[model samples]
Target chain A: MTNLSAELRQYLIITASYWTFTLTDGALRMLVLLYFHQLGYEPLQIALLFIFYEFFGVVTNLVGGWLGARQA
Target chain B: MNIGLALQVVALGMLMLPSSALTVAWVMAAQGLSGIAKDLNKMSAKSAIKFLVTDNAQGTLFRWVALLTGSKNALKGAGFFLGGTLLVLVGFRTAMVVMAAALAIVWLINLIALQSDLGKSASKPKFRQVFSKSSAINRLSLCRLFLFASRDVWFVIALPVYLAATLGWEFSKVGGFMAIWIIGYGAVQAIAPYLTGLRAGRVPDGRDAMLWALPLAAAPALIAYTLNSQFEAELILVGGLLLFGFLFAINSSLHSYLIVSYADRDGASLDVGFYYMANAMGRLIGTLLSGWLYQVWGLQACLWISALFIVVTAALSISLPRSGSTLPTTQ
Candidate 1:
């Protein structure tokens, strides 16, 4: 770790953060899925919980691309 | 910093909420916010990878890309089980608090340790350049849309809910199966190039893409038929999903490689971003259809729609150029 270049070290840092984020994100989905179902929301109703989640996902990808390009 | 702050806020809100406040509208709103945060993190990390790898080694590039994505997915599978276990051990509100605290730590680590100027470009790209001009890119993006929709249509909303509702499986059991399903999917993704013979020095081409995707359409169709036929619903659906996951992983890894390969070195994010936008749109479409179809008809309808989407994906793949999106139209 000490001998690696700054670029490689930075890469590892970003990758680690990304990995942790994914873990929490997955956990969040399961938590929501089972929690709502436990509360007796119908299957479709439970599914509706993520409608906005997935919809806004499309919005983010487009805008995030542009944002990534413009970043200084 | 901003996304982390926002996620922490949302998590805290969920942590302290009253039972009566847990309306469909409330949870949906929260999920929407989380979705935005997820994509922000995803796009940034994916864009960052191109910078991390050496330009000359296409093979190493492919491997790194697959490794990053595959490992993230495997951890995500673990997260599913973690979520279930947390719920069982600590219950909902406490689980939210614990996750929020952990994420806050991640945020702090990233803030202090990672370089601030990671993906900044020398010349800022104009907003109008956001859309890809390459017809190959446009065509591949279309294929991506249908391909992801094909998977999410059954995977996202319908499957876990169905297991719990129809089969009378417990939440732990549903989560466990899903964790296994996703872990297997991610594992297949990690080894896709090998399965496709990347070792043979064959970088995946459109023909490879089509061949990988063609068999996928059949699995869902068969699964749906078996369920409709009432031939041991649990075994067929679960087993069928595992088969579907394997094929879908290969098809998806091929696309992942292509999108990175097709992207312009400068503003690579622009192309990768456009492609994933389509991917997200597919997920959006599939998620909605999964809920509505499962509610109105059953998982059978979701499976059928999935097969239809895959057929469109295969159609689009047939015309893709052999290499980069820069190639002249094969037509």
Candidate 2:
């Protein structure tokens, strides 16, 4: 495990982390949408619950990556 | 040092907590956080590629980016199915908890192993720098915006509801079809480079995009016409959608490679970030229009509008550089 180059190790970590996050994000969305539908929430209401999801995603891409940048 | 991992872990926990306390506002707020988490993770991961791969290896870059984008999309398909299965097996809150715990472990490994300073530019980029200065990037971003809108405007609201309400197909059938379509689309995207002629050491050029997107513009228009012409509505629409999906996947995968190829080496995330912002805006606009247009004019109208958007996308693709051109000069 320790034999790989540092760069290779970092790459693995990033890909693994991204994949893990994707699984949860996908599962969680389905969980919410289906669960709420079963609980009698209106379709419009279900859609509304995700209103900020895409919006926030755009905002994060534009700002958060910059904000996290260290003075290299 | 990886801000993306933190956001993702927090998002999972938030999902777990919100299920038991199901106020509408709370759920929406959690979704907002999840959205932010997603983009952060996406930006971080993609930008990491630039640092990992050498710049001179354009072929490697294309392959790697295609692999990453393709696999992520395929996983997203799995995630969708997993979401439903978890809900059925463990209920919502428990499902969230289990996912959260699993992601936390992944996050932990990332923290312990990943070296800091990856994807950081040599200088601190001003907040405004998120808006890319590259004319090529700007143009490509515009094309991407419309391309995605063309898909979601019809696919999001018009298609599923139309199939369910109008065609009398079962809900599960509709979902299964869409899921299969998405997974297939992802698979195509992974192999798009080969399909679009990435072999023999040539990368996709603007002309290739133009040639690829040429037929795409006519597809929906033809489908909409066929829908009115009395051919089996389900057959025409479904078959048209499948064709559209394949073409769109190719165009989209090419664009993804182009963006990474065009971005500046230092802090490539800025360019990537700006591009995806346009993408998200397009989706938002398309989603709104999908519902409205379908309501006011019917699904045919939505398809027509989608055709119209693809026309503009095709036009934009033409102005892109010839195969040998290095810069994305505006035509």
Candidate 3:
């Protein structure tokens, strides 16, 4: 790891972080799906739980990129 | 990145509260936080890649983007399996506590490992610039929006519920099947460049995107037709799902590569972010339709909607520039 360039090392770190995030994200989705179904929620009701999640994702991407770009 | 990780921990913590306290609205709120965290981390990670790779190294860029996207998806599949197994083994609240604790540890490590200046750009981009100005980007974003919407329409709420309710599969079976499908999808995505002639020094363009969509659009349609004809529902669905996962992975990988290639090198996050915003919007619409359509009509309706969206995606792909988004760095 020490012999690799700075960029390669940085990429690895980012990838590792992203991997952990994705893992949790996927698991959470399944947990919600099965748990709520077990609780007898309607399909639409289950979908509603994710509405805000997807909605905020739209907002975050639009603004987050600009913030990332402006960072010095 | 740290903020995103911290938010995820908090989201999990919210779920860890006692069952009586876990109201629907509360879970939604927690999910909202997780959503924000996921996109922030994703946008930053993707944009950061532009900084690591030279402008001329587009082949390397494609490989890196595919690997990251593919591996992330594969990990997501593992997460699904973990979620299912944990629920059966320890129950929901316990699983939440375990995940939150684990993610908190990962967060602390990333806090120290990530450099402060990772995605800092030479020029500061303004808020208004967040909306992309490039026609190529705009077209690709449109395709991406519909493409993702098509998948989520069937995959999100409809498929799992259908598998469990109608087919009488166990939670573990449903979750396991979904996990294997996604893991296989990710594997295909990782190898998409090789399948599409990257080995022969051919870099994909808008034409490739269009070509891939044509077959994907047909897959769900065929499934829907077979199911309507009183064929074995379980067999048809499983077969359709495998076909859909394979074709969709290639189309998705191509788009991932194109977006990174087309993004402005100076502040690549701007374009990548806008593109994913459309992607999120697609998921939003598809998720909503998945629930409503499945409740009112059935899984077939969701499959039809998916097919329609893919057709729209193919149409939109036509408007993207036929010329490659970036110069191919021959490996």
Candidate 4:
């Protein structure tokens, strides 16, 4: 019972932290777009930049998923 | 026909529109962050189960936590809608700046909030081992890959051009349609858990739920093409939008249940990397192909192609093994 309580506390802490990160990460992404636009990239250029971003994400997601599965 | 694959195809197709770089970045970043969040969730569940094995009380607590996590999808959807609308009104550059700053703050808070135990550790198993032991994982990956390769190419690249040429919508209006479609999709997700429970008895199982929802999913796009009047077209499109929401809600829950359960039963976790890999590859193919399709064929042809893709995915959904319940496996 005591151990269960301890685990719950840990889980709650972790969840809270993760959610905070999730929210901020979302906000930062918005900021990146603004930075790129301010640099004088046209709409088409911006679209291409996004394609690059998605391309990078594809790589990272695979790596992250692989890492997560292994850790579990 | 996996819902995730379908959504990825849709997202890739969205990139083809004349949206700003900021919007695309936001979408891609969201995808990456979601990948990380999913992995963390699976690990949390595994640890929670371990605690339960040692002490039952902890197991129940973990279950509640898991439920809480599942429910967060709705809140996230609302946030996306609010954020996206706000960005549209504020100008793309301003929105990007605000969102980026928010991301930095989130990162810092996450670091502070979670103890070291929540962080990724070196002691975790090597990546290869995660897939090495599971034949099912490999099979599922192949299935996802095949589905993505076949469907996404036409939808992402070809469909937008088709809509533009045939329907005479500007890029922003195209984006508006996409936004509405996504919002419809998210709305379904918000209510899916409850909806599933309500219809649980009527449907034989979760697999059946997916099968029934399959055809209805394509109704919106199919109808939108038939109407020539602008208002009529919009009405049909909205209907499709609603159907899209409904179908996605049902299909997503089923899809999640299958993948999560398979992982738990096998004492494995769905490799978030592999899952996203399949997704990204599908999108890459889908987007490129869609672009080609638009060049070669007319917009009407592209809509037909998108419809065909939906039909194929729906049929594939019917063939998946029938899981006992739509409830996500927490551990």
Candidate 5:
């Protein structure tokens, strides 16, 4: 019973951490879009910002995968 | 499951969730589902091929592939139209949540349906087994990198910049173009099983089949790039996109073949996650470089670079060895 409770606690902690990360990420994205809009960026410019964001994500994913493979 | 059943489930979920949440949730869920789907589709390819090659197998393979691909295409198109219409009518938040919930439901149903299809087995190598062997690890990593470089990063980063700078398209127009491109792409994939099945009888060998399709599939982009007028550009873009979709479908099928073959030799599921990570990582690099490339050299240069990358990828695809005959067991 105690072990099960510990497992549940661990799961809860992980879930909470994940949610926090997601929320923060989403909020940052929203803020950036809003900021761009305020700067009078056109729709294309806003889209480009997202493209830039995705570009960074691609790099991180690549490096992360490489590291993960190396670790494995 | 039938297309009707899938649509019904999606519609129900759409009704239940808020619009904004539905859109956001659906897109996220779709991305994850796509990842899982890629893995499963690869795993299933061996069986699918076997079904195709074996005589008197009830044509079950063809039917299933057709159904799966068709349903996916129809569902995606429907989902997009539905989501857009919902956003216009109800609001974005509701659409987001509803779409997410709908996708989650579809994924659950798919999970149940696929459970029985995956054969019972302990086929995969242990993590320790894979890690301890240097050659196995190196080969897997290299192949993963190649797969990543071939797809995700290259197109996603280059295409938008290519349009904006070369054509002076507004962002909204680019978005519309992208939406159309994706729909056309998915539609092509949905029909790919039929097309490939027809071609399978003539090719005999896997490698030859993929090699032959590579350039033919890639030619549309170059053709599109040649057009000068805006309307002509849009028409060529759509045509090129359709070709791109066909090329990707073929590439995906071929990649699956390669991955499964590799898995059979090394006996591990580490490749799946590693492969996905590689693709995602490439996207990151491509996206970042694309921005810089645009700022420095403009759109035409980016297109040329993208075209060069595709040609290189096509060349590499020809050299991939055929070895594995079974799916790698997932951990």
Candidate 6:
């Protein structure tokens, strides 16, 4: 790790974090959908469960750039 | 970025509460947190890439972007499978505990190891700059919104329910099928450069975007057409979906590369974040329509809507500047 350039190290870290995050994100969605279905929630009800999940995504991406820039 | 990871852990924990406490509102709130966390992590990682590659390395850029985007998607598919299996095996609460704990460890490691100075700009961009000023970027963003919308419109709710309800597939089988499709799509995206003529030393442009979108636009309509003709529904759907997934993978990979390519060298996150915002908006729209259209008009209607969105995507792609062409600076 010490021998690698700073740039390479940073890139590796970013990739690792992103990969872990994605796995958990995907898993969480499946867990919720399947679990709710088992609870006898209607199909439309199950779909509605993800509405906020997708809606907040819109908001995050909208403002997240400005937040990133402020940190930059 | 560390914050994003930590928030995910917290969101997972929220889902671990007793069953009686887990109402629809509670789950939606947790999901909202998870959504915000995921996008923050995504925006940070994507923006960071612009700093890693040197200028004038278009091929390298395309490869790296494709690799990152592709692998992330593959992992996401794996996650879907993991989620299903865990639900059946350890049950939901235990699964939540396991995922939350694992993510916390990742967050801690990232907090310690990541350098703070990466991606910082000399000048702080104003809030308004978050809305990109470049016409090229704006056009790409609009195209992206519809491109993603086209996929999610059919893929999210319509396709899965159709498989379960109409086709009579088991829950695990449906989950597995979706996992395989997404993983295969990711595999194609990783190698999209080769498929799109990167081997011949040519990178894609807006013209290429339009050309690729044309075939993709036909796929859902074709599926709708064949199904209407009373052909074997199962074969038509499986075959048509595979074709759709393949073309859509290439289109998505191309868009991912082009955004990084078009982003300004400095504060690339501004544009990347803005582009993904549209992507998120598309997903929101598509998910809403998927629910509404499937309920009212069935899967056929959803497919028609998906086709319509793709046509709009292709039309938007026409105005995209060719590679190396001077783009209009202002929106």
Each candidate: fraction of true contacts kept? 0.80, 0.61, 0.81, 0.21, 0.06, 0.68
What is the full ranking by lDDT, best candidate first?
Answer: 3, 6, 1, 2, 4, 5
Order of models, best TM-score first: 1, 3, 6, 2, 4, 5
Q: Write the per-residue lDDT of candidate 2 for residues B248-278, one digit (tens) a residue.
A: 9999988877776665322244434567577
The regions of model 6 sitting more than 4 angstroms off are A1-17, A65-72, B43-69, B108-125, B130-136, B198-205, B256-274, B319-331
Winning candidate number (lDDT): 3
Error of 5 at B308 (Å): 2.2
In angstroms, give how far residue B132 of model 5 lies from its true place. Answer: 10
Model 5 has fnat of 0.06
Candidate 5 residue lDDT tens string, B1-331: 1222233334334334432343433433433333332223323333333333244345754664454444444443443334334534545445445544544554454445433333121133322222323243334344434434444333444454455445665544444454465556666655554565534433212354346445743554475366445557666765765676666665555444445445555554442334545455555455545555645665445455555555555555455544333333333
Sort by DockQ, best first.
1, 3, 6, 2, 4, 5
Better of 2 and 6 by DockQ: 6
TM-score between candidate 1 and the true structure: 0.82
Categorize the docking of model 2: acceptable
| Model 6, span B202-255: residue lDDT tens | 767788899999999999999988888877988989889899999999998888
Top candidate (DockQ): 1
- Which lDDT tens digits does candidate 5 get at residues A1-72? 675454334333322222222222222233233333334444344445554345434433334333334433
Which CAPRI tier for candidate 4?
Answer: acceptable
- Pitting candidate 1 against candidate 5, the one with the higher DockQ is 1
Two-chain DockQ for model 6: 0.54
- List-wise, what DockQ does each model earn? 0.60, 0.48, 0.58, 0.23, 0.06, 0.54
| Model 2 regions more than 4 Å off | A1-13, A34-46, A63-72, B1-24, B46-67, B87-91, B108-124, B127-137, B157-175, B198-208, B226-231, B256-276, B291-299, B318-331
Instruction: Say which docking band candidate 1 falls in.
Output: medium
Model 2 / residue B21 / CA error / Å: 5.7
Error of 2 at B133 (Å): 6.1
Give the range of the ten consecutive residues with the poorest summed lDDT in model 2 chain A. Answer: A63-72
Better of 4 and 6 by DockQ: 6
Candidate models: Cα lDDT each: 0.76, 0.72, 0.83, 0.48, 0.43, 0.80
